[model samples]
Target: MLSGFKLLACLLFSGQTPTENLPAQDFDEYQCSGNVEIDFPGLCALLDMKNIPAVCTKQPASLTTETEEEDTDDNKSLIDDSSIWPKPCLHAELESEDPLSAKNLKISGWRVDEQIVRVLQKMLLSLSKLQSLHFWQAGLTDQMLISLLNTISLCSNLRAVTLEGNPLPERSYHLLLSEDSILTHLSLRNNRIGNEGARLIGSALSTTRSANKNLLSLNLAFNCIGDEGAAHIAKGLRFNCALLFLSLSNNQIGDSGAGHLAATLAEFALTHEEVVERRKLLLERTQDSSLRVSSDQSSVGQLPSVPSSTSLSASKGENKAKKKEASKKEEKPAANKENPKSNKKSPDIKVPQSKGGKQGSKEKLTAQEDKPTTALNEQVEAVEIVNPLLDRLVQYRDGELILPGNTTLSSLNLEGNKITEKSLPLFLTSLEMQGEEGGLLRLCLQRNLFSPDCELYVKIKELMALRDALNKNTSEQTEEEEQGAQC
Candidate 1:
C-alpha cells in the first residue's frame, strides 16, 4: 500500500509546478535579447548586466512604423512640436508607480568612461523626475565633469547632487553652481578643491549681472581651501542672499581666512562696485517716478473737452454776459466815485481783473508740480557726490548705513581647520554686533587650534545657543499656525 501511494504521488506531480517555471519566465522577461522597447525596468536590468551598447542602440524601426501609420494629423503635429525625439518609455503604460519618479541614483566605485557618460546623458534627459544623483569615486575628469554639469543644468526637477570623492583635474566644479542653476543642495566633499576652485565658485555665487539665487546648502569639507579662498568666498557672500549652510571644515583655513569670514557676518562699508550699483538703482527709481508724474499730468491735460455744440454755445453766451456786466460795472464805478461806501464795493467787484492773485496761484501750482522731481534729482546727485567722500574718509558715519553684509547665512562649519584663539575674538565681536539680526545659528569650532575653555569661544557659543532657541520657538509657532490653518 505504501508503494502504491508513492507511485500515485509521483504520477500526479510529474508536470512542472507554476513556482518551478517562474525563474525561467522571469529570466526571459528581463533579457533584452530581441528588438523589444526598453522601459525603466529594462533599463535597470541592462545597467545591472553592464550592457551599455544595448541601452544606447536605437529602437527597431518596425516597432514605430505601425504607430506612425496609425497616428492622426493631430498626433503627428504634436509629435513634431515636441522637443524630445523618440519619446522615452518611462511612462508609456501609465504605471501608477514609476521607478525613476522621485528616485535617487547613486553610482559609486565605478570608472565612468565616455560610453557611460553618453548613457547617463540619455538617462538624465529621460528621467525628468529624478531628484538627486550621487557619484562617489567615479573617476571623472574635467571634461567629463563639464559635460555632466551641462546635462544636469537641463534637468529642471533635479534638486540635489553629490559628487564626493571625484576630484577633477581642473577647477570646473564651479560649473554646477552657476547663476541659473536649480540645484538647492550640492556636496563636493573629498574633492581636493583649492583656492582657484573656491574663487570660481564665489564668482558663480555673485557676479556683476546676477547671483545664484537657488543654492541653499554647500559642503566643501576635506579640501585644501585656505585664506585666499576664504576671502574670495566672503566677497561673494557680501552680495549673496539665498545660501543658508556652508561647510569649510577639515581645510587649510587660518586666522586671516577666519577674519575675512567674520567681517562678512558683521557690518561693513560697501565696495566701489556696490556703491556704483546703488547709485544706478537710485537714478533708475527717480527716472521712473518722474516719468510716472509726467504721464499723470499729461493724462489730466488730455481729458476730453465739452464736444457738444449746445454746451459750447452756452459757455460763449455766459462769457458775453459777463463782458457786458463788467462794462456796466465800469461805468457805475465812475458814477459812484462820489460815494465812499460805493467806491469800496466797486473795487471789490473789479478784484477778478487784477493779475496778482491769478499769477501767484499759477506760480504756486507750478512750484508744487516741480517740487518732487527736483527733490528726487537732488537726492540722487547728493548720493553720487557724498559717496566718494565717504569712501575716502575714515570716520565718515553720515553716509548711508543701509548696506549691511551677509545676514542670510544660517550656519558655518569650520571645524578641523587651522583656526586659533587669535581669530576667535573676531568671530565673537561679529556675533555681538549682529545681536538680534544675525542669521548664524550654528558655528562649529571644534578640533581647531583654540582651547575648549577660550573666553571668546564660550561667548560665541552662548550667543549661538540663544539664537538657536529663538529660531526653534519661531519655527514651532509657524508650525502651529500652519496646523490651525489646515484645521
Candidate 2:
C-alpha cells in the first residue's frame, strides 16, 4: 500500500526515483495532457491535502484537458476580444489543520508563461516553510525571472537557490541584489549573461548591508564576460568581503580583463588594511573614553553630594529671615489691636494699596522662592555625563563599522581566452598592487596568450616570493604575541 509521503513525492517529482514514480492508478488520474506536463497545481494540491488517501480516492473528471478546453471556450464566448488568454483557474486550497506548516517546492525544465508565473507566485505565497528552490532551464525571460524573484522574496525561509540554464537579464541581477533577498548559495551557471547583467550582479554583491552578506557562494561560469564586464566585477570585489567562492570560467576574458581584475584585488587589499587600522584606533579611543567615564562614575559615587551643604545653608538663611518677618508682622498686628482709633487711621492711610498690594507681594514671593529651588534641583540632575564609548556602542548597534570579514576570492578559472604578454604585464601589475597582507591565494591563467620568456613570468615569481614572505611574517608575529602573553 502507498503511503502519503510516496504519493506526494510521486506528484512533485515524477520518475526521478523509483519511489517517486506514481502508482498506475494514481498516474492515470493526474489529468495531465499528453506530454504537456501541466501538473504544477495538481502537485500543489497534493501538498495542501488534509487526508491524502481520501482526496486521492475521488479523482475529479473536470480536471481533464478536454473539460478545461471546453470551460475556456465557454468563458471566451462571453468576451469580445479573442486575443485574451485562457486562465488556469486551478485552485490549491489550504485543507490542512496546521496553517503554518508548508512543504518545499522544486520544479525544473518547465515551459514558462505569465499565467504560470502568476499561479506559481500565488502558490508560493500560500506556503510558509519553503526552504530551497531549484529551477533549471525553465525558459525564463527577464520579466519571468523578475516575477519569480518577487514571489521568492515573500518566502521568509528560502535560503538556497539554483536557477541554472535560464536566459536571465540585467534586471534579474537587480532583483537578486534587492535587500529583500536572503539567499545564501545562488547558482546561475549557463545563463548566457552579458556585460550589463554581470555589472548588475557585481553591483548587488558590492552592497555592504545584509543584502549580499548572506550570499557565500556564487557561480557565474559559462557567461561570456569580457573586459568591460570584468572591470565591474572587480569594482564589486573591492567592497564585498563576504563571498568565499566565485567562478568566472569558460568566459571570453582576455589579458586586459585579467589585468583589470588583478588591479582591483590589489587596491582592495590596501584599502582593507587601512580600514582595519582605522577601526582598531577608533576602538581603542572608545575603550579609553569608556574607562574614563566609568572611573568618573565610581568617583562620583564615593564623593559627597556637594550641593547638599549649600542647599542646607540657603534654607537656614531663608528660615531666619522668615522668623524676623513674622516677629515684625506680629508686633504691627498687636499695635493695631491695642488702638482701634489708630487702626481706622492706618487703614485710611493704606486704603487701596493695602487691599491688593500685600496679597500680590505674598504670591510673588512664594512663586519666586519655589522656582529657584526647583530650578537648582533640575540643574543638578541635568549634568549630562557624555560617554563617547556609549555613543560608539550605539553606532555599532546601528550597523556602522561592523562589516563582514574579507574572504579572498577563491577559484578563478581564466581558461581559453585571448591572453598575451600585454595582458600579462597588467595582471602582474595588479598583483604588485596587493598590500603586504593581500588575500589572493589561487589563480588560473593557463591556455592564454603567453609566450615562454614573457616578462610576466618574472613578475609572477616576484609575487610568489612576496606572498611567502607575508605568510612567514604573519606566523612569526603570531608566535611573538603568544610568547609575550606567556611572559
Candidate 3:
C-alpha cells in the first residue's frame, strides 16, 4: 500500500512528485487547463524559495513548522506543523482548529495557483500539527488542489484564512465548499474570478449549509463575480442561517446582487424576530383570508360570566329588564331636548357607521398620518456614498491632501484620545491582522491609523518589508510605491 503521504499526493496531484510541481512560465500562468511539465528545482531557483546547499539559503516550496510531542512538550514558542492535512474543506477546518496552535496553514474554496498550491498541498499533508496560515496570491493551481484534497480528506476544526490572488476553477471550488467546514472567518477577494467560480463555491456552501453555519464572517470582494455569481451566493445564503458579517465589495456585483442579498438578509432577520409582522400580514392575506371572522368583535373587552342552567331563567329575565330600561332611556333623551309635552316624543338619531366602512378606515388613516418616517432615516438621503473609507485612508490625491467632506478616517482609530505618530502604523498593521479575500491583499488603513513616525518612517519601513515579502512570494506588484504614505 502507498504511504499516507504518497497516497495524498497521488490523490491531489495525480501522482506528481514535488519536483514536477515547479513553475517555468512557459505558457501564461493564469490558464488552469494544461499538462505542462514542471521543473521544481528550476522554478525554486528562479524564485528565492530553494534551500540548495550553500547556493540558495531560503527554503523553497514552503515554510516549515517546529512541532513537539503533544502534552509532554514544554516549548512555549513551538507550534505544530500543518503539512499533515491537504484536503480543502477538511484542511480549512483542521487549520482553524486549536486557533492558537498552527503557525502557517492555508485552505479555502478559490482558484489556487500551481507551484504555490503544491507547497500548500505538502503543508496540508505533512504538518498535521500545524498552527497558522497566511497566503496572498501564492500560485495555487488545479492539480495541486487535488493533492490538497488528498492530504486532508477528514478534519474537524480550521482557524482563519487570508486568500486574495490565488485562482482556481469554479467547479473545483464548489467541490471544496461541499465539505463540512468549521472555519469561523474566510477572506477571498480581488481574484479576477467570474460568476462560474462563484456558482461552484455557492454550490458547496449549499451542500455544507448546515455545518458551515459556524462561519461568522466572509469577504468576497473585488473579484469579477457579477450578478449571477452573487445570485448563486444569495441562494446559498438562504440555506445558511448563522452568518453575521458579510462583505462583497468591488465585485461589480451591482444593484441586483445588493437587492438579492439585502432581500435574503431582511427575510432572515424577519424570521428571527419575535413577531414577524410582514409575514403575519402575508399569512393573513394568503392562507387565512377565507377564515376571516367578523372584525366587529372587540379584541379586548370585559369577559361575561357564563350562566348555569339554573341561572339561565334569571339571566334571560335580567336581559329583558335591561332592554326595557335602554328603550325607556332612549325615548327620554329626546324629551329632555324638547318641551315638556314634546319631551315624550322620540327624536331621529343618526346611524353609526359599519365596521367595514369609512368609520373604521378613518381610524387607520389617522394612525398612518401619525406614523411618519423617522427624521434620522430619511434625512440621510442627500448623503452620497462615494467610498468615504477610501477618501479617508488614501489622503494623497495628486500629491495634495484631499479629505472628502465629513470623511471619518478609520485608520486614525481616534475614539478616546488625540491621534499622534506612533499610534497610526499600529492601526494600519491591525488591518493586516484581518487576512485575505481574493488572495489579492490590500491593507486597509482607512480603518486604522498610524503615528506620524509610522506615517513617515515606520510605515515606510513596514511597507518596504511588506513589499519585499509580497514581491518575493509573487510578481504581481505593479505599483508598490503607492503602498506607503505619499503625503
Candidate 4:
C-alpha cells in the first residue's frame, strides 16, 4: 500500500499533460525584507507562483544599518541615482504571468520614478482579484493617482485601500466615490483631500443604495476639512448606518461643525441599531420560510423544484412581451388623439404662410409687450433681500446647519475647534435630544476657546461623567485639555 501511494504521489507531481501542477502549489505570501538590491525578476517570479496572494517589499535603503549607510557618503538622492543610472526596461521579465492571483500588495517607501510608476500601473491593471492595497510613502502625487483612476475602477472586489503620505488631489481621490466601488475600509492619511473632497465622499457614503453600504471604517486624517465640510459630512452621516469607525483628526473643524458632528453621532446610533435588528429579523424569516418549504416537500413526497436561471429568464421574457403588448394597446388611443392635434397644428402652421408678414409683426408686438412684465418681476425679486438667518433657528455660519433630535451619532471628535461658551448651550440641547439611549460616549473638546470658570465648561464636565446607579457607563472618555488661554 505504501509503495502504491508513493507511485501515485510521483505521478501527480509529474507534468504528464504538458502543464504545471498549479493546483497543488500552496505559495500564498512573498516577503522581501533586506538591505540588498531587490531582484525585480526574482520577485516577479515569486509573485507569479500559483496561489500566491500577498506581496510585501520594504525599500532596501530603509533596511540598511548605520555602518553600511556610512560606507556610501554620496550625497546623491534616490531620484538622482535613478536618473544617473537608469535600470534596463525589465517590463517583459518582471510582469507577473498570473497577476490576478494576488489579493493584497504592500510596497512601502518606494523611490518611484517615471518608469517604475508605469510598471506599477501596469501591474495594478493586471490584478483583477486585488482586494487590499497599501502605498505608504511611495512618493505618489496627484498626477500619479489621476493616471490610475481607470485601473482603480477595474478592481471590483477591492474593499480596503490605503494611500498614506500620497499627495492626492480632489480629482484623483474622487475616484473612491464611484458607485461601482465596494470599499469597506479607506485610509487617506496625510493626503491633502480638502473640504470639497470630504463633501463629495460624504455624499457618496450617504447613498444607502450604493455599494458603499458595506463601508465600515474611514480615515481622513490630516485633510483640510473645515466647518462647512464637516457640516456636509454630518448631514450625510445622519442617513448612513454601516460606518462604525471614523477618524477625522487634524481637520479645521470649528464650533458649528463640531456641534453638527456631535448631534449626528448622538442621533445616528439608534438608527444603526434598528437596522441591525431589522437585518437579523429578515434572516430569521428567510430561514423559517426555507424550513417550511422543506417540510412541505417531505410531506408531499415530492421535491418542489427551485426556480432556475433559465426559468427565471423565460418568465422575465414573457412579462416583457405582455408589457409590450399592453403598451401597444395603450399607444393606439394616444396616437389617435395626437393625430387630430397634429392635423389642427399643421393647418395653423400652414395658414401663417399666407399672412407671414402679419404673423411676424404680431409675434414681435407680443414679445415687446412681455418685456416690461419680465423686468417688473426681476425688480420685485431684487427688492426682496431675504434674510437667510430668519430661515434658521440657530444662526452659526453660512452652510453649517444641524438638526436636533434627528441623529444617531455615538462618538464625536471635535478637538482644536473654535467652540466657546455661546455654542455650548445649543450643543448640550442637541445631546439631550438623543435621550438616554443616544448619549455621546466620546467627546473631544481640547484646544477650544472656553473659559475655565464658565458655565459651559461646568456643564460639559457634568455631561461627560454622567453615570447610573448600576454603574453602567454611558460616556467613556472626554478629551478636554486646557491648553488654550481663557477668553
Candidate 5:
C-alpha cells in the first residue's frame, strides 16, 4: 500500500491549465526562521473572487457586525449577524409605498422564522427607493424568487434584481429579468443557466426605455454558457454599447466563445469607424519608429560621431552580447524537442483506495487523464490583436498573465493559458527583449493545456538555456568584482 501510495502521489503534484509550478525561491525570497531553502515554490490557491493580490474596493456606507454567543447546545451558529445586511446597491420597492423604504435589509442567511419575516418586511419597506436587490445563496427557491420579482414590479423604483447561485431555471428567470427594464448590473454566477438564460439576459440588456437608459456591468461567470450561450450574448453585445465590463469567466466558453467576443469587439470598432482609423494610424506609427531605429543603427558607421558614441556605449554592447547569447541559447529548446525531458516529469504513479471508498476498489486514474494534450493545425483559427501588449503570454492559475521578470531564472512553470503558434513570434520576441538573464533565471513550461505543437515549449527551452548561461555569467562576474574590491 505504501509503495502504491508513492506511485499515485505524483498524480496530485502536477500543473493546471497555465500555472507551471516552480521552486518559490527562484522568484521570491522566503528564508525560514531557522532553516534555509526548506520551502518549495507553490501558488496560493487562486479562486475566482480573490486571485490577484489585494486591491481595496469601496466600502458600503454601513457594515453589519455580529457577536458570537457561547452555544450551550451542539449547534454551531455560523450566521449570528445575518440580519442587518445592507440592501444590494441595486434595489427596488418590495411592497411599501414609502419611496425610501430600504432602511431595513438583512444580510444573513434566511431562517424560516419571525426574524426572516422581519428582514423581508424591512426590504419590502425599501421598495420605493430601491433600484436593485441581490439575495445570492440564501435559501431562496424558484417560487420565492418569482414572488420577489412579482412584488418588486409594482414599485417603479425597482430596476435590478440578482438571484444568482439559486437553482432558478433559465426560462422563468429570463421572463423576470426581461420585465425589469432598469436592470443593468446582473450577477448569475454558478447558476445552471444555459443558452436560454443568456439570450434572456441579452434581451434585457438591449432595452433602452426612457426609464432605463444605460446598463453598464454584467457579471455572469461560472454559468454553463457553452458556444450557444456565447453566440446569444454576442448578439446582445452587437447592438448594445452602454455596457463597459462583462465577466464571462469559468464557463464552457472555449476558443469559439472567445472568438464570438472578439468578433463583437471588431464589430464595435467597425461600427465606430474612428477607432478603426486610429488603430491603423498607430500601426503605421510603430512601423515608422522601427524604421527610424534601424536607420539610426545603420547610419552610425559612416560618421566620425559613431566611434565616440559606439565606443563608450558599454551598456548597448552588453545588450547586444546578451541578445547574441540568447540567440545561441535558443538552440537548446530545439535539441529538447528531439529529446523532450519535460515529458518525463512524473513517473510517480499512485493508487489510493482506502477508507474513503469501498476497500480495495482502487480508483484508477489514466495517463491520458493525467496528461492533457492538444494539437494546433493549419485549420486552427488564430486571433489577430492590434495591440502587442494585450496579446496573451504565459499565465498563472485562473488566467492571470505571467511575464518573465526583469532578470534570468533557473526554473519556470507557467500553466493556465493557451499560447500557440500565432503568438509564438510575439512571445519569443518578448522573451528575447527580456534578455538572456531575464531576472527570471529558470524557465519551466510544463503541464499546460496547450497544443502539442506549442512552439512555446521550444521557446521555453531556449529561454531556460539563456537563463542558465546568464546566471553562470552573473555568478562569475560577481566573483571577479569581489576579488577586485578585495585587492
Candidate 6:
C-alpha cells in the first residue's frame, strides 16, 4: 500500500482512481497555503483526498452585514474572498521570473462546489497570462456558469475555452458568446442545448446594434437543436461576418432546417425590414456628412482676423486726414465755378471691379461647370453604398435588387442530422451558387439520412473538392510570398 502523499501523487499523475481506505493521518501533515503555483500535494489537500466523498457538497453560505451585502450586489463574493480557498491547478509553459506566467488550466473529473468556484475565480483573476481553460465533466451549474463567465469577461488575455459534458439546468451556455466577450474559440459539446438556447445564441451572434466580432470558431455539437433552431442560426448568419467555422452535428435537424441553412448561402431578395434598415442607415450617414461639412464651414467663417495696434492707429489717422481733405474740397467754390463741366456727371462711367467681385464671378462659373461631374459622382457612390452590417447587395435579372447571403463563414458542419435526400438538391444548388461567387469552401453532410451515391451529393462533393484545391493554391502562394518577404 502506498502512503497518502505518494498515493495522491500517483493518482494525479497516472490518472488512476483513489482508494477508499486512505488514512486521515497520512494527508494531515500536508497543507495548502494558496500559492499561485500549485503542486500535487497542495492539490490533493485542497481536494480533501483523505475524506473523499462520492458526491461533492456545496459550502454553507456565510452570513454578511448589510454593508457587505451592498458591496457584493454584483456577485463580487466569488472574487473578493480570495484568501478563503486554495488556488486551482495551473500549468505554466516555462518557469520564469514573472509570477503570473501560467498559460493553461484544465480541471477534469471534479465536482465544482462553492469552495472550488471561489478558488477557480481567484486563480483566473490572479493568472493574468492564462490563455486557455478546459473543464470536462466538472459539474458546472447555471449559477456557477454565470459567475464564471462574468469573471472571464474581465480576463484580457484569455481567448479559448472548452466546457464539455457539463449540462446546466437553464441551458445558459449562450452567455459565454456575448457581444462583448473577447474569446475567439469556444466548445460546448454535449451540453443538452435546445432550440431556445440556440435562439439566444443566434441573437448574440448578430444583434441589431452590434454583433460578436471576436469569435471565429463555435462548436455546439451533440445537442438537441432542430429546424427552428437552425432557422434562428440562419437568421444570425445573414449579418455575421467574423465566424469562420460552425459545427451543428448530431442534432435533430431535418429538411426544413437544411433548407434554411442552404438558402442563406445564395442570393435572395431583401425583405421590407432589411430595405427599411438600409434606407435608415443611409439617411443617418448623409445627415452626419452634412453636419460635418456645415461645422467645418462655420469654423472657417468664425476664424478671428486680428490686426496689430500700429495698423489700427495708422488707419484712424488716415481717416481723419481724409475728412479734412473732404472739407477743404467742399470750401473751394470758386474752383468749382471755373470748371463747371466737372460738376456734371458722365453719361457712361466705367466702374472699376473689385478683386472680391471678380473672384465671386469666377467661382460661380466653375461651380456651374462642375455640376455634371458632381452629379455623376453622386450616382456612382449611390450604386456602391451597401449595408455594412449585412452582406453585399446585388442587382439580379429582371431589374430586381437582391442581397447576397453569408460569404464569410467558410465551413459548416451538419453531420449526423435528420436531413433526407429531398434537401440534397437545395444544398447542391446553394453550393453551385457559392462556387460561382468563390465562397463557402466546405459543407459536411456525412452520416445523415441520405444515400452516399446520391447524384446531388456527389456533385456537391466534386464542387467542394475543386474549391478546396483553388483555396489551397492561393494559400500556398501567399505563404511563399510571406516567406520571401521574411528572407
Superposed on all Cα atoms, the candidates' RMSDs to the truth, in angstroms, are 21.8, 26.2, 22.0, 19.9, 28.9, 21.4
What is candidate 6's lDDT per residue for 418-486, written digit by digit as tens? 999999988888777765555677777887998999888898888888776345554443332122100
Predicted candidate 2 versus true structure: per-residue lDDT over 1-487, tens digit per residue = 2345544554555444434444443422444321112244344343443322111110233235643554344323323224343332322222233333333343433445665565466556555655666565566778878778877877777777767557654448556755446887786766677788888887787633222556776767666778888877776765565666666666777766777776655532224443344445445444654564466456545655565876557655645654564465455532232235334433211223342565645433333322222222222224432211111111011112222223356434454456666766655655555444445554555546776566676667566555553444434423321221000
Off by over 4 Å in 3: 1-102, 105-129, 152-157, 207-211, 268-487
- Model 5 alpha-carbon miss at residue 388, Å: 32
How well does candidate 2 score on lDDT at residue 476?
40
TM-score of each: 0.58, 0.46, 0.35, 0.46, 0.35, 0.61
In the range 124-163, model 4's lDDT, one tens digit per residue, is 5545556777665567666776666566667666678877
Highest lDDT model number: 6
Off by over 4 Å in 4: 1-104, 111-131, 146-158, 207-211, 263-409, 436-440, 451-487
Which stretches of model 2 miss by more than 4 angstroms?
1-40, 43-106, 125-130, 207-211, 268-407, 425-438, 451-487
* lDDT at 98, model 6: 42
Q: What tens digits encode model 3's per-residue C-alpha lDDT throughout 215-268?
A: 555656546776688777765664454454455544555445544543433212
Candidate 6 wrong stretches, greater than 4 Å:
1-35, 38-100, 295-391, 394-401, 469-487
lDDT of 1: 0.60
Model 1: ten consecutive residues of lowest lDDT: 478-487
Clashing pairs in 1: none
lDDT of 1 at 74: 20
**CA lDDT of each candidate?**
0.60, 0.50, 0.37, 0.48, 0.39, 0.61
Cα lDDT, model 4, residue 436 = 70
The runs of at least 3 residues in candidate 5 whose Cα sits more than 4 Å from the true structure, single-residue gaps closed, are 1-108, 111-132, 156-160, 207-213, 268-487
